[model samples]
Target: MKILLNKFLPKWMVLIIDQLIMSWSFALSFFVVRQFEFAEILRGHFLIYIGLFCIVSLITFYSMRVHTGLIRYSSIHDIYRIFSAVLICSVAYAAFVALWLAPVHNIDSVNIYLVLLLNFFIASTLLIMVRLGAKALFLYIRSGTAGSKERVLIYGADGYSILLKQALEASNSGYFSIIGFLDDDPHKIDKDIHQKRVYHVNDIENLQRKFNIDKLFVFNEDLKSEFRKKSIEKCVELGIKVLTVPPTEQWMSGNLSMKQIKNLKIEDLLQRPPIVIENKQVASDLAGKRVLITGGAGSIGSEIVRQVLSYNPELVVICDQAESPLHELQLEIKELFPDANVAVCICDVTNFNRMYSLFKDFTPEVVYHAAAYKHVPMMESNPCEAILTNVLGTKNLADLSLTFDVEKFVMISTDKAVNPTNIMGTSKRIAEIYIQSLNNISGKKINGNNPAGVAEPQTKFITTRFGNVLGSNGSVIPRFRSQIEKGGPVTVTHPEITRYFMTIPEAVQLVLEAGTMGKGGEIFIFDMGEPVKIVDLATKMIKLAGLVPNVDINVVFTGLRPGEKLYEELLNEKELTIPTHHSKIKISKVRNYDYEDVVNDIEELLKLNKNKEELRVVKKMKQIVPEYISNNSRFEQLDMHMN
Candidate 1:
């Protein structure tokens, strides 16, 4: 049986089999009509009649290509093809008898016509039955030997869901046994589609109890709908694994494969509504302009590079200190946009001469500064490095943009920069101040603030601040996912600690929008919907992995790391945000700084950092940004002393 079902028969072989089946049908018809009188049937032109019928069947079936479809994978179209072929053969035979046989010989036309009609019915039925019977037999034997197939249920009862079901069954992977469909429509519920029952969405629990369902398949759009989101969550809570079907565009050759159906990830459920951007506005800003993206290989920066490249920029300079990642980004850009003119520069943003040469060479009209050491605890241990890169790197780009008369300088900031309790956040806050102050400096030489000999700086400095990006480098989501994959003891910083989460794409979209709308000296903050608890995130991640939270894998809550806060703030106590044209973005009403004072303080801080004065560097950072109070760190002592 396995050998027979292993591969499809050749078309010629299938044609022979079909003709033999039709001949058998003709013999059965004769037996029925003659009342088993074999002597009477053989006494006349029975041999010639059967020979003529076989020739007609062969011509009609071969012309219709009815044998082209695989018998084991037959569909409704195949059945229709077979039926049409048989009907045409029957009609042609009748025409032949009337035109040639009936006139030339004394024959009973009624009996011949009756036999032809019976042959048509018998042949059609037998052909369709043969294919269906083969399919059923194959499925039955395969199921019995291929282990117990997982009984699954599909979420939607629409045409897409039905097509998905057909695709899965026709693949012959022998893994899923679809029990029924769960639909929210009252008209579709309790109805049968393609021999599968459609149950109400509310009946998932009952269906689980009855059939012991192993998985629930859903379309991609269901994740965006509020009602469907809750339904999926309910299934997750009930411990049924949820699988999501990719969008139609992702299908291979317009057909869904078993590999295309992926397990739903926690990030999919946590995502907010789709962000709509002003495409024309962004295109106008970036089109045909030389754009530079610092740290272009990192998560946020890489997404920025991709989005900006789509705007048809004249040239894109992807600069980063990391050699391998920078090379990889260059390769990716070449693969994705073969016509795009992109340059890759491997140089530290902290080196003045290197950055100066970069600016002189590329001379980007728009600069997106994303280079910074962003980890909180890691920067807490090494404060000076944070200041040097985050503050100095930003200053280098901002000052160069002014000297080169760049149109805009957009700096990526963080929510932690608001009430900065860590060195990383404080350093970012200092960078923001320098950017804002430079934008506020009206037509001044900056008191001889190193190079950039200009009367009035033409650069529009902008800052975009947002919360933690989901799936970014060293983020909690990826960490939790890794821990769950290893099979035990997923660690959460604290049970009660919560942080605002946004997808990397979402953050980058808002940044581009903010950059487009910024005039200068304005700090833009994205609307992070709500704070998610660390423990809950861990639990959902474990559950998404098809494991129980506490039973299958233990979630251990370690104490918060140094300089980690229970909550991240987008706005400080003294600042307020006003709504912008885009709902997801707002401009912060932050205090303006004196350009001279900011320049003086930052220059001294850079000198201290250069001298490796870590303590002095951090102390000077606190003095520059008064909100730089440390939390749960050795630097917290410094905060207390200042108070």
Candidate 2:
């Protein structure tokens, strides 16, 4: 009968169904209030009052949009809205009955008072319960066989767990049986959660073996590593998955799913306390300013452009040499903010005269130099080219910023610079040194000018150094996504390789904020969360695509490339990085190179450009960055012989 009603009845006709529900609710209220005994004349006269009650509640519910909401999604928010509307309707009914309906029906004063109060309570309760009944069915399916019901266990069985269980049970998405709960608190031992006794977490093995449980659901609001580690180890041993649903915000962001058992990430198992962002300074730094981004078409650069725009920069200059990308960046800028003055420039930072010309012409207030030969293998093949671009290009930009008097110069650097294992890292380390030295000398020159009464602009130079951005062009994420889409082999350099990662936007925002915190010469090392195993990354990518790893998609390990590290480092043995106002930002304390010494070294490196002595160039980089180590390179011979 319900199926037929739903099939033939238009949605507008559902209002009639709602009216019937209201009438039924009113009748049930009287039965509960009057102990199921009919007072004939009283019942006949009260029908008018009951009818009025149903009409008012129906109208109120509709107006409040409570009726229009999907009955199957009656979350606490939905219930709150329903109850609010019901309360308003009940109060109006009470007022109307007391003022007008009572005299018309000639209901005795005492009886009318009793009826109104009792009827309001019963009717309001029934209305909510009926919608909840629909919502409850949805929760049931979401938890159990109706969805992806791999037998699972819930830990803690706390209020959140109860909410989780209800949502799972009523969700038409699946069926979640009352798999008994587990709690460490002994006082709650043998306690029934909907008649299911609370079991010890140690009993997971027994349940996994018995029910063939496919997953373990951890429901602790906060995760303790010892407990989380034990749970994961047990699940791994049993070939069962351990999943966490996390906070409500994670659920709303689509990061956590109802099917995704609300709980913790692997990070939670090994999490340190979160770093606090210095909000006031971050907002004030770029709240209203003109910012220019070099390589703005590239990953980190483009992201910088996006983030700075969010802080409402007066203007953002996106400069890149690549034709296709710059065009796309312009379009993206147009689509995102049609009114934003995002100018596209087709100039390379390596061209000193051109860069200086642009700085002078555009009068850019700040510049973020992100352009460089980033790919390690490619840079290894073209050593001289990498040196020119990474080292000399940085020189051009910094010198130009100093000349044109730009507000700040932010050079985006990499974690590979920490204990350099590749030419790319070595080159970046060289660039950092060159940029830092220039900033120091520039400060001296500016200070010297003060005594001569010569005016100079404050060009604060800052370098934001971090490891890797996840989905930037040519990043691992895009490569893995493409490979998985092609229906096969996901490539990894080595089975043991790992690197630190942060979302592009998150990294970019920190980069911009770090740039503004510079006090002349400082390399702000970003606090990258933690390094993730490449193999595990590949596996997750495969599974997220709903494909089995070995059976469906192959993950092939193809030996490490030239200059690549099995694991990237963020700090050096002899280095010290002091914290800023933000725990996530650190300032490296390093020895300063003399201006004459720096100038001489740069000249020596440039002379080697024609010498075909690749080792000499790498050695020169070592002189600049003492921590530089040439991993798997012929340049190691140069250092050995020099010693």
Candidate 3:
């Protein structure tokens, strides 16, 4: 019966019902004026009077479309429509009686003006009350009456909070009930919104105790990072789930739904303030210039590509050996920036002839060399591949950049290169040394007396070194997420192991700023904020997934993998950093390397076949980087023998 009524009610029936109520209100007003004498209503042309009132009321209601709204979902706007219809009917009836009807019919039973006013008030009130009652009943029925609903406290007392509450009440999900609001604004504290008290954020514990708040909904787009982090931490500690709604603009058709709200993740808490860059300098360096980016499909390199495109580069050559990822990147670029001048090159950097052809063809003004094998354990086992890519590939790019007279070459290095204990880190350090030495020699040749057959050097090599990037491929965060999805033990290398972390975009922004700020031969080190312990990170991730750490999901400490370290360093013991204009960036000072000798040693190291004599390659690497020490691996024996 309820379904039939909800589905089959027509607009004309609503119009007829409103007219009948207004007629009844008119009759009741006469009865009240006549001192409860029901007979007095029938004394003087009462039937004609009621007929006139209905005619005027129907005209006004129809014109206003007051019957168009569904009663069960009526809003304040529907009330306004009802009021307008009543007021218009009252005015028309008063004018008809005073100017025309009284003289034509000689009817003087009661004051028509007072009767019309009374009808207006009674009719408008009844109409609004019916709609409100229906709306409330519908909400109650949709929200269900059986199970205990989870009480939710909204974190902001604003428009979004009100809308979220309305959405929750209207949804038939029967999962959540909004208790009240919590705001940081002092003036808003203790105030009432929608009959719910707004309390300060500090009152969360009291509210939780009183209302048993099972969740907190944060909808404030302008929330500060520190306060957000603190609130999330407090919520986690109290075992209350924290959720967030999408931004106001993202709401669908000015309506929010329960599906739009999502549980807050560990990433939200770990995010730092946005990095500010010297845009003018970066634009000046990149604008209208041809730029080449190796590993353009990978995380750091792809971010560099996206950021560089914003600077309006004349052409961007995306060079990566991976075909599928490069194709995906190309498709994304086409969708995002169809007019962007971009070309994809699927050639390995180590392919000297192909790279030479590319350089000769395009003659890039700047090159961002971000291609490297970064997985520690994988690179530990495949030392030869790591050296081939990180060392020889870098050398190939550097030599070609100089030969092609590229204006600037920005090489992406890592914190692992500092005080290296792993083959990957050592190879990167070797790349860094060779590039710095090449830059020094190029500068000397440019400044010195011109020798026969010697060309003026143009390429300036700059290296930007930072730590792990969040959300990068094969990073710990993704691994933890996968493990959590599988509902099993999350593996950590060591309980005490720690590493600095930064967002990929932030790291790339600093890289661009450092690249633009460099003159030549400078290694730029970024200030990666506090290092995070891997075990704590895993525990937090598990908890954020609504699972109890070590109970629902276990974090097992596997012994550190080969080439792994308990702590990572941004600078070697022998190198110190000098301040730069940007506080987050610094310039590293290290002993200069002899360019010819470093090049000859790298050539010798590359010539040794890993298939036949891998130890000889390791020994040669140790010879190049005197600080290279192997720990907890088979290569440690080589170190012992050398000692």
Candidate 4:
């Protein structure tokens, strides 16, 4: 029977049914007026009046689309339509009787008005009630047929909360049943919303016990971070799955759905306030310029490429050695900006001739150098590759930028370069030093020499440094997520280890902003918020996955890998940062290097073969970066021997 009703009836059938109900209502109204005298209602003008009422009601109902809604899925809109149709029919009938019929037939006006009013009330009420009853019956059938429904509680009692409940109820899946609402507002506590009592957030445990809530849906916009964290923590402790709806703008066709509700992620919890960028400054610098981005297919590189498109660059040259990722980026750019001019260059940055040729062909006005070998442990084991890519690769781009007279060359450096502890860090530090010295030397030469005496280099070398980017290739977050999905122990290098984190987009935005602000020879450092402990992060991730840390999922502490530091530093002790126009960005003050000496040292360092004499290569690195200390690795012995 329910299945048959689920098959929606045709519009004509619904119209016919509604007309029949209106006719029955009119007859019932007459019987009530005439004290159940059926003979009088069947006589004279009564039959004609009933026929006219049916015709007018059918016309109004069809005009208002009152019969267009499915009885089993009727909503408030459908009810309003029904009311409109009945009210219009009643008004038309009263006007006819009062204006013509009552005076001509010598009938009482009050009696006629009363009969029409009663007819309108009965018709509207019965029509709405039948639809409501059918809707309830369908819901009951669905709830019973779909197996056991998970009892859930909403964490907010606001408008979004009500919408969420409606969406869940309307869902054909019938998996979730909303038990009640939980809010932080003291005044709202004990109040009823949408037929559900609103309980204080503190009463979650009690509510869970009473209602057996298996899930909690969070939809509050003004929820405090601390309170949110605590509430989620409590929910995890109670074994209640926490789900969240997307922002209202993301809703499909202004309607929410169960499919749109997703499990809260660790990234969502750890995310800080969004970093606002000075768009005008970035746009002014980049507009109409041909921008070249090295390693433009990697995580940070790709994001930079995407963001740079907004400034309307004359041509964007995406240069990367990785062929497949670069191809992927080219396709993405083509799809997103088919009209914009973009070029893809599969040139290795370490190959000087190739990069030189690239620079000559493109003649890019600005160069954003983001290519580097950044994995600490991997680079520690393969120090030769690290130097070849990170250090020499940067030098090739920097030298070519100067030679090509590019307006600005921005080098993307990392926090690990500050007071380095690994091969990767030291290599990046060396790169930073080379570019800064090159900037200073070039500026001095241009200022000191006559224009005819020497061809002046007019390039500004800018460096932007920040900490780890969330969800980057081979980052800890993805690794932890994969481990959780595999249902095993998530690996942590050290329990006490901590690192600063920022989203990839945020880091790239600041880089662009810093590029515009740089004059020459300045290393801009971003303000990375408080470092997060690895152990705490791992624990939270496990809990977010609905598993107890060390109980449901074991968190194993693997001893620190080679050259991996206990904590990463944003600035070396010797370096002091001066204020920038943006509070989140600062300019670092460091000791200047002689361009000649630094060039000689790097040339010699790059000369050694790492496979035959790895220690010799590492010793040269330490010499270049005196503060480079090897921790928990074979390179540590080199530091002791040097001392």
Candidate 5:
């Protein structure tokens, strides 16, 4: 590009030099037109104006932030600015010539205006032509230069792979010549994308050796874990760079600019599964309705609030105990949608009286109860606080949402609820039962007004069950990043332990979609794609960061936490599920309790949690989620381990 600009600058200088050639030619034409020597001398003054005009225009172009740098790929707006600047400067010179020379040199206004008009028309045409021509030549030279173009390969022979290829060829985004695709699928072998063949994965080396390939762009959506390490190793052996593009970002739009492309990010290295968004109807019930998001500063709560805002809700109340995150959320909401009527509230969900008042004042049509003590280790140590926040806090909100006539309530749950062996999961299971039993008991009691020309409110309760969010607070990804930055062993509990993962947007979107799908007493389970082993995850991260695993950094095996599992199950041994809109998400079938009986038991448990034995609450949790079984946890030895 720099060389092309250098070539373009000399051509422009030659055009300036043509002013002298044109001057001598015009003098010869004048001698022919008037057949006199005096007329020939008039071309001298004309030659001076032509030379001065070109010099002044070139100087003004540089001052206007044009011409000095490469303008081959400049936008139309840039060209317009250049033309405007040159035209203004040329017109000013024409005015000065007519004002002074009209009386002294006897030059006419008509001739001066004609020269000004023609100069602008010709200068704009020539300037634009030079810019466009330079860009074409730059691309030609860039593509044609020996050993300059990078030979790049892509993994996955799918729709995204094709889009990635087209985007690279059609735009100045990635500076790579896409050779073809690499896939393990036998059916895709020898197939073509944009006339480029989809070769077998085994053939990547032959191509790398043949063409001297530089990089491999893997589609993160279709990456298989077992082969990921092998694929990365192959690239490293061949001294080739490996890059990845997120499936969602496969369709690049307005953000594609040369300058922007240079500032690339590494999100594609994250190996989370493809997000399957099925429940689109979840947000329908929330449209134009007042909504409240407790723990709004948190990962799940913040996402819920953001998704709710998109539905054009009547009002959104963001409540959280944390002050710093609340202030940040306030600024974000204000900047995103200035017209939105959003309230930033600093009410802790554990403070029953305060939370109850806040819920009553706003009277949210839908309440997303997300606040809880979720960190496994933290909740394990402070069992009482977890009970107070997750168990009692849920009870308070669920009761208020019922009493204040809220339309619907959605609770965010985890797979840990399936046979919970820790305080956090146990506390959540208690809350889940309270929501389920209440829906069974309170049917249509929240009707807005009287039956005769009055509003009728039917409170509906829905619970969204899913696994870990990728980059949430206290997530393992951030922990690994921190550990890796410290340049040492990155800890993994067990080489065989694995867990399901999803991006924040994907999880929250599914929650919104599922929320609107429920018809009271339904537990929505999101299909978190394949589970990635913790050991393999650390290995991939090390490779992505350009470090050799087990050599440069070690993977330490730390014993699992208090109630941690080697493998997490989405459902219990007896639990069954049926499909909904998308195959990945489902509705779990579980036993429902009579509203009054369960509610009475929960109220007794809440009081007992304060004065009675802790086993009383643990036993109630076991009863609610019948699948719940005590695993390798202190909670199982309640009385024996109390001391």
Candidate 6:
């Protein structure tokens, strides 16, 4: 029986079996017509009638190719074929007997027609049922041999969910056994679909207690729906792992594969609704315009590059100091946009000569300055490099934008720059001050000499500030994920530390929107919804990975690193935001400086950084921005001296 269930019968054997079933149906028809008097029915032309019916059935069944369907994977289409073949065979054979055979053999047409009618019904039922029965039997045997199947419940009771279930069952992988469906619809509660019960969301706990469901399959769209979102949260809270069904568009060759079903990640749960942008405005602004991205190889910068490319830019100059990452970004652009006009340059933003050559060559109308030393601790230890890059690099780019007449200079800033407590934040705060001061004095004389020696600046310097970006390089989310994967302690800086999280793409979208809207001298802060606790984020990530926090994976509190904030603030105590046209973006009413004074101070600061006098450089940085105070660092003593 195992072997028979394992291997399918050949086509010829299937044909013979179908023919025998049809013959039996015909015999049963005779018995019914003769009122169970089998001897009477067999008396005169019974042998000839049976032989003639078999011949007709063979011709029709073979012509219709009824035996071609695999019994173990039969579908509604196969059943339809079986029904059509049987119906056609009955009609054709009965018509032939009534028109020619009945008259030629002096047969009673009424009696033969009745038998044919009964035979039609019996044959269709048996044929369809035989295939269905075989499929059930095969699945049962396969499940037993494949070991204990995982009991799962699908999340939605819609047609798409049923189709997904059918696809999963049809696949040769006999590991999952679908118990029922879970839904939030009140109307669908406790209903039966395909013999499986439709369960309500409120009953999830009871269902889990009763059946111990291994997983719940949810459609990708349901993850975005509000009601479904709550249901998914409940399931997660119950420790029932949820698997996401990819969109139908991602299905391979119009069929869902087992590999395409993925475990739900914490990102999915944390991501908010999609942001609506002014696509036409951004497209018009960027179309055919030359654009420059300073950190084009980094996460936010690369995404900006991609989004800019989609706007049909005339040329994109990708400037980054990282060699391999720049090359990889170039390759990715080539592969994704074969006809894209992009130039990749390996040049430090702090180098005026190299950057000057780039600006002269590309003559970009728009520049997005993203290059900076962003790691808090690293910058805390190395203040010289931080000032050089974050301050001087930004200065170099702003100066060149003026010399080159760039239309927009969007500088990516951080929330850490708001009343900064570390060297990294202070340096960024200095950069923001320089750009805003420069914007205040645009198209006018400044103290610094440009390469072109042009006095009037045409560039609009705009600053965008936001908190931590999820999944970016050196971000906490990826670090936690890596630790979890290594099966050990996941180190979070503090238990109560909280930071606002935004997806990389979401942040970049706002950047582009903010860039397009800026006239000049505006510090645009994005509305990063609610702050997420670091400890809670860590715990949820461990749960998402199917591990218990402090049990399977130890989540250790390593205390706050140098210059780390227990909470990040988007605005300083002295600053307030004015409403912009965009709801998520607002302009900061920040203090501005005189361009001449800032230029002189920055020049001296640059000299100190050039001599690698880290202390003097940091001291000058603090003097320029008095709000810059060191927290839990070696430089804290400097802050004390100044105070």
CA-lDDT, candidates in order = 0.88, 0.72, 0.85, 0.85, 0.71, 0.89
Model 3 lDDT on a 0 to 1 scale: 0.85
Instruction: Report residue 312 deviation for candidate 4 (angstroms).
Output: 1.7
Give the per-residue lDDT digits (tens) of candidate 2, residues 484-575: 89997999989899988876766776776687678778888887776789888787666555567877999999988877899997777677
Stretches of candidate 1 off by over 4 Å are 1-14, 26-65, 84-121, 136-147, 168-171, 174-179, 186-211, 248-255, 449-454
Q: What are the RMSDs of all candidates, in order?
A: 3.7, 6.6, 4.7, 4.3, 7.7, 4.2
Number of the predicted model whose TM-score against the real structure is largest: 1
Q: What is the TM-score of each candidate against the true structure?
A: 0.89, 0.71, 0.85, 0.87, 0.71, 0.87
Q: Residue pairs in steric clash, candidate 3?
A: none
Error of 1 at 235 (Å): 1.7
TM for candidate 2 is 0.71
Residues forming the 10-long window of minimal summed lDDT in candidate 2: 1-10
Off by over 4 Å in 4: 1-19, 26-73, 85-120, 137-147, 202-212, 220-230, 252-254, 444-454, 609-612
lDDT of 6 by residue, 153-198 (tens): 9988988888888877776654688899988788998899988899
Which candidate, 1 or 3, has the higher TM-score?
A: 1
C-alpha displacement of 17 in model 1, angstroms?
A: 2.6
| Cα lDDT tens digits for candidate 1, 1-643 | 4565477789999999999999999888877877879899888777877898899999999889988888877887898899899999989988988887788877777788888889889988988888999899877766765446788899888887888888777766646888989989999888999999999988888988999888999988889887888889889988899999987668734447778888999888888779999989999999999999999999999999999999999999999998888888888998999999999999899898999899889889999999899999999999888987999889888888888788999999999998888999999999999999999874555556546565676788999999999899899888888888889799988889999999999999999999999998999999999899889888888888889989999999889899999999999989988999999999999888988889999999999999999888888989998978888888877777788
After aligning candidate 2 to the native by TM-score, how far in Å is the CA of 208 from where it should be? 3.2
